[model samples]
Target: MKELFKQIPSVDQILSKKEIKDLIDKFGYPLVKDSVRKSIEKVRDEIKSGKLKEKIPEMVFELIPLKVEEVIKPSLKKVINGTGIIIHTNLGRAVLPESVADYIKSLSTCYSNLEYDIEKGKRGHRDSHAERLLSTFFNVEAATVVNNNAAAVMLIINTFAEGKEVVVSRGELIEIGGSFRIPEIMKKAGAKLVEVGTTNKTHLEDYANAINENTGLVLKVHPSNYRITGFTKSVPAKDIAKLCKQKGVVFAEDMGSGNIYDLSELGINDEPTVKESVNAGIDLISFSGDKLLGCVQAGIIIGKKEYIGRIRKNHLLRALRVDKITYAAIEKHMELLLREKYHEIPVYNMIFKQAEAIRKEIEEFISGFKLENSELEIVETSSKIGGGTTPEREIGSFALTFNLNKSPEEIEQYFRSREIPVIGRIKGERFLIDFRTILKKDIPILKNYVSQLLSH
Candidate 1:
């Protein structure tokens, strides 16, 4: 063991080797040195543990380049979304419109009026950029944006209901993704949560009864992720707004998905739109920009100018404000929405795409695959509107189910091992490919990947 340890080359000697020197030329000195050190340490440990059978120099030389490549690989590389969950949170919620990337690139190359007003030649508010667009689309008085939906909720609570009672129904107190409960958020924002009515039912009178001198705001939360159907009753937003008006308290709603247009036309009738909430006379409303809106992640707050003005003045607004990139993307997405270009946005396109279209795409994808032992067939599957929106509703979709010679787990692993990993679901001894979430451009890539795997 001592002789084997001594036989291991020094870091300097390893770096001087032709292969490692080539890596140094390609990557850099620091990375190559680190990789060599790690490889040497690993080989020494293995030798001590009696696991290293190869000669020390051969093992160290072989492992150095692999370690260097591993170290240089990016952590946030993009992956193909074969999973039919539109707005899949883990795979990055909403795929922004390609125009958004163009906008970002254009902005990246040059400076723009992110804050300064070009006409006035003076400092301007960043909120002014998207405020008018949001207000116009939603028919609200004014609008502002923050980092995300959670920040929107927190800002509203901290601004209006901090250190005061914010009335809400027990049923509307939902726990969003990652254990973020409504009650906990309220507490964090310095608001006293006043729960009214039972989980299954909360009437108008319950909200009216909860209002008192200490109450600063009446909050109505849209439970975006889950639905509690069958014999359930809750106070409508209009009624809640009316009650808050009578009580002389602020009425605010946290619409989780931030839907701009009515999805009911596409058969998703249950999800409400921002227009409806604004029409209901809710004084303040907040929603997500990334979910149903098909834009980058942002928390859009639109409401009466007086209330939005106050929210902008809150000290925490500075901490939760978005940067130029977000403002730019959102502005472009809003323009697309205004122009009625629904197909431009990926989320809307996926939701409204015909089942027949997806099936055709799948047929093309599977036609290129000549698997000796794998059988591919088109099967009917349902795609979900994920990212905590419309939990119960699933868009009708088509999938290519694969009955491979290998186990389902092995097939899944094989696709996952690709350069841009293919993420699909497995069910009942077969691997499934839901084509709704898979873009048309991704087909060639998928075909090449599958062909390569079969050839191997």
Candidate 2:
């Protein structure tokens, strides 16, 4: 055992090796040295446990760099989403349009008038960056942006309903992705959550009876992730707005998945657009910029200028405000939407995609590549508007499926472990790469990776 320990190279000796020098250049000297010390200690422990029988210096040299990289691999990386779910929250929620991404890069690398008013030759407010574009889409008096919808809700509730009763329906108290519950957020904002009506139904009179002098705001939360069908009834936004007006209370809606375009033209008619919510006489409204808006993550609030002015005066606004890059992304995204270039946006492109086009692309890919040890076939699949947008509405789509000797889980892991990881879904016994969600530029990359995978 003692001789086996001696056979393992010293940390200093390993650090001096030429290949180790290459690792130092890549990972820096301090990290490489720390990794070498830990590896040496691990080798000593393995020898003490009688796991090593001979000098394996060659094996150690061959694996040391990989060990160091394993310790330093970044958790966040660019990955391909083949799951047919657009606006996938786990996969970065929304992908910026190519033009929007390029705009952000250009603005970020240099400097722009993020706060400068070149017209006035003085400082300007950053809210105008996206707020101006959003106002044209709705009849809103004013708008402001925060980091996310949750932050928007918290900020608005704190601004108007703190230490007061916030009347809401028990049916509308939704919990979206990551366990973000409506009641919990209201509590954090110091609002008294007074849940009214049943889990399946809520009426206009229920809200009217709940309001009193102590009532500050009536919140209507959109069930963006789930649905209750059959024998269910809910109050319309206009009726609630009228009731709030009569009671002299603030009425706001957390209209999740802030859609700006008319998706009904594309055969999706379930979700109501942000413009409809604005025209419903709602005194205040907020929605997510990432889900259906096809932009960066932002919580946009628009309503009466009086309430917006009050919100801007709140000290918490500073904590919840977005940075320059986020403003830049949202502004450019709004420009694309205003131009009616829906295809330029990733989320819209996926929603607007036809199943036939995806099939043709899959056929072309198959004809070009020679993948061994796997059978490729085209399959019909369904895509979804994920990130809690429109739930249960399956859009027609297509996938390139693979049937290999490996198990489904093993095949998924294999693609997931690639340099640019491919996240495909396993349905039945086959692995699927849905073309509806795949970007046009990524098709060649997918073909090359699959070839390398099966050729081995």
Candidate 3:
């Protein structure tokens, strides 16, 4: 290696335009000439520092070119959501329906009615598209949307209670997924947070005692990411609303991960519905469109027409307003929910799929995979409503478990890096392909990918 290094010229001689172009051709245009030029510059700097022992510079030239491609590539890309964690936050929570996608694509190329009232021939509200549908679906007097649930809370607090006290249960001051804690948001919104009780227990008295002349709002936040059990107490939205009404304070319920449908019929734990919260006579109720509602990234506020009107007039509403694409998608999703087209929403379909159908699908796929003397079994597994919803509920599911020649981790990584990633769980030293969340159409694509990987 030392003799080979001696025979090679200085670092400056190796990086010619032709050589760089050759490397560019090998790696696609994503890397190309810019990466090679930068790598060459790095090597020159390394040589000046007396770090080049011939082979080191060549190695540096080779390595830095590869690193540059990775450094410049966009962090966001499409990944198949096969982890069975529907609403997987890290993988872009809440996959929009095909109708929503088509609508977004249709409006992208042309001018839209986003801010124009066609009937009146005048400027219009951006929330007009989704507002009526949301109101009808949630049974509220009116509705408005912001970019996300966090922003929705911020807008409400800043609009109604900035520089005033907002009382909430200590248990309800929960941290949502992604470290977005409620207290932090309240502080940033310029509202003073008054904690009312212990983490596991909070009473209506806690809220009543916290209310005083300067208190502007009574906030009740749902602990979406976690649940407390065993000797626990909570104040219902109705009770809080009554208290707020008597005290002349604004009532707001942060219905985190609020779903419109009843999931107990689908064998999942019972979660509070948005309509129920609204019927509690609260001044305002806020929930996420992406989680249980199964829509786009939106913070939906539904309440008394007057309060929603105030929220709409807030200056921050402009900064947190949803765009045309979001309005289109949210409108379509709400329509589907109202029409009872439950199957159209992928998250609902995955969660509510029958266990028997999942087993049959797994059996059919297993029959196609001739394992070459390897043993495979369609074992019963459990699915979950991940993305920090329903932490304790496990749905019945089926999985295809096989003993592969490659290590389980290696096979898992292979699927992860494949063009269409197949994320599944590994159990008892075997990779388990859970079929509850896997769509029927995805089965063939998965089979082909596995066959290709095993063949190589």
Indicate which candidate wins on TM-score: 1
Please report the TM-score between candidate 3 and the true structure.
Answer: 0.88
Best candidate, lDDT-wise?
1
TM-scores of the candidates are: 0.95, 0.93, 0.88
Backbone clashes (count) for model 1: 0
RMSD of 1: 1.9
Q: Name the regions of candidate 1 deviating beyond 4 angstroms.
A: 15-22, 369-374, 453-456
Tens digit of lDDT per residue, candidate 3, span 179-271? 898889999999999999898999989888899998978888877878999999998788888988999999998887877667787566557
370-389 in candidate 2: lDDT tens per residue?
A: 65544788999898888887
**Per-candidate total of colliding backbone pairs:** 0, 0, 0
Scored against the true structure, residue 227 in model 2 reaches a CA lDDT of 91
The 10-residue segment of model 2 with minimum total lDDT is 54-63
Decreasing lDDT order of the candidates: 1, 2, 3
TM-score between candidate 1 and the true structure: 0.95
Residue 165, model 2, lDDT: 90
